[model samples]
Target: MTLYGFRIPKFAALFFWIVVWEIVGQFELMLLFPPFTEVLAAMTDVVTTPSFVEAARITAYCYLVGLSLAVVAGIGLGLLMGLVPAADKLLNMWVNIFLSAPLSALVPVIMILFGMGEPTVIVTVFMFAVWIIALDTRAGVQHVSPSLKEMAFSFGASRVQRLKIVLLSALPEILAGIRLGVIRGVKGVVIGQLLVSIIGVGALFSLYSQNFLMGHFWALILILFAFALSLAELIGRLEQKVEYYAGARG
Candidate 1:
């Protein structure tokens, strides 16, 4: 693959990191960084365990629900703000504030409002994801050309028809936003469950950490990273498929 104009084999960088990790582990440089092989073995054990399966189920539930809510609400609000200048003016400030705010600080408030349960974790994921999506969707809509709207109107297109065309034109940006939001939602789920300290993958992390099971801890982390990366890559491919819509907007 080419990166920054440098050609390298697909797995070369990964192999290099694995070699470095093995060297570190062999020298006993740190108690926490286990060898690559051992970590892979631990991953096998983790995936087969009942606790891992249950934790994964819970995490997936919250992640999917939160992401679904974020996608719907973010798109709806974004369309409103984009099409209506008054709504844009009213919501833009708050959207920017939340987007820039340290959302971790709001976890306690969320817990208090929703209680220390799955709902709290789900809400946390929504909070982390919704703002970027809203902002991106709004930006995408604003970028849609005035001529397209006028053309549609001139063709006797109804309001709903105009909205459909505009949204399709914005699909690339919307997918990009959703991709980013999914990554953030992953973080939100981990943080929310960890703070609660008695549930799901977070509880497994806590258990592994307290017991100094470095292999298991890292394995769980790798699992979550793989899941997040896969989702982002899938959305990214979808964005590519819709690139024609950007030209349609013009």
Candidate 2:
């Protein structure tokens, strides 16, 4: 049969371990790890709390602002750079420096500049991600079919109209870059908050670890993982919608 008699996912492995955990827990092999049942019960409580909602709202706001600005500025600057050889040459060195640097190391410096709060976290996310998104957008523009641009020009399209019609059509690729930027920026938010935030999920994670609440701690990790997966799915759907619209137009 096919690999254990069906199309089984690797995640099925977690179910196996969870069953083993419940058995070991019943036998008192360990308590702090908690049984799968216990952790699931704790998850329902933790995920529903008002405090968790507030923390989620704060994180979402920070992520959106950071991601939105990165998209606008990244695409704008990238287009300009791709269009200008002299500009790329002049800024290439600095761009490479920031891109290569390990942004986690810059959190403290960001904190120094903006203090230990939302501003620091926002700046941290922006610094780590904007360049990569910009680089991708630039590449997308460069690789756009030259024929599409020439058609617009031959049809007497103005510069503004050409950008709006022709260049804008390439947005699905630019959006692909933005999707990556937001994901990368989210990681920065988690790290920045963990390092300096006083009242967010990071604070809760630190508090739980200190109190040795392993089950609850694992619950929080699961929540974050689920949140990230949900976001990626949402972006993937948006990409598909764009493709559908493009096809309909043709």
Candidate 3:
């Protein structure tokens, strides 16, 4: 970032917001916001509680399982669509529709079908994440240079070899999609648990809200935000590392 033609640290904006939030919170400008210092203080107690430990475990399990399914299915579907015009014609409309749709409305339907359990939450996370991953993967695959494929063919590369080449070439976009999917998956997990209203971190959110424990509530939010940002930064670094593939293809 730059201000007045001077370079600013990347975290300057975040620090600025933190100061603003602290000021607003200290002055009781919002009923929902407690002092930021109190929220930070509550973080220790929140993390140490057995209830929070159990909630964290359940949230992690649901998130990882759901995201794993999304990655596999999304990549497979994307490859199919990218490699086969027929598949693209058949599925592209639906993919676009789901990608743009407000998926939260469908959560109730999922709950009805899967019942009020971990399965429903997992499905919610998957639904929130999969479409974008598929779309991005399809784009990556389609963007693979025709000459790369031709070269592979002229070299007597088998069908699997061609597919591997495409995947490697598309690694940058695939990782970008996964990084985005990871973020969406976090929202899914949180929304699923909140709507379920009886399990995981959602239950804790409910507990804090009903009792007006804003400090603990905000602390939990900060933890989730930190986790999501950390994951995104890690994936972004990986994306940077693979960017040479795109340049090579060009």
Query: TM-score of every model?
Result: 0.95, 0.82, 0.98
Candidate 1 wrong stretches, greater than 4 Å: 1-6
After TM-score superposition, the amount by which residue 43's alpha carbon in candidate 3 deviates from its true location, in angstroms, is 0.8
Q: Candidate 1 lDDT (Cα, whole model)?
A: 0.92
Please report, in order, the local distance difference test score of every candidate based on alpha carbons. 0.92, 0.75, 0.94
Candidate 1 per-residue C-alpha lDDT over 1-250 given as tens digits, one digit per residue, 9 for 90 to 100: 8989999998798899999998998788999999978899999999999999999999999999999999999998888898899999999999999989999999989999999899999998999999999988998999998899899999999989999999998888889989999999999999999986368899899999999999999999999999999999999998999999999766
- Judged by whole-model lDDT over C-alpha atoms, candidate 3 comes out at 0.94
**Tens digits of per-residue lDDT for model 3 on 1-250?**
7889999999899889988989999999998988889999999999999999999999999999999999999999999999999999999999999989999999999999999999999999999889989999999999999999999999999999989999999999999999999999999999999986469999999999999999999999999999988998999999999999896478
Q: Per model, how many backbone clashes are there?
A: 0, 0, 0
Which runs in model 2 stand beyond 4 Å of their true positions? Answer: 1-36, 244-250
Candidate 1 or 3, higher TM-score? 3
**Which residue pairs collide in model 3, if any?**
none
The per-residue C-alpha lDDT of model 1 at residue 47 equals 95
Query: What TM-score does candidate 1 reach?
Result: 0.95
User: How much lDDT does candidate 2 score?
Assistant: 0.75
Q: Candidate 3 has what TM-score?
A: 0.98
Q: Sorted by TM-score, highest first, which candidate order results?
A: 3, 1, 2
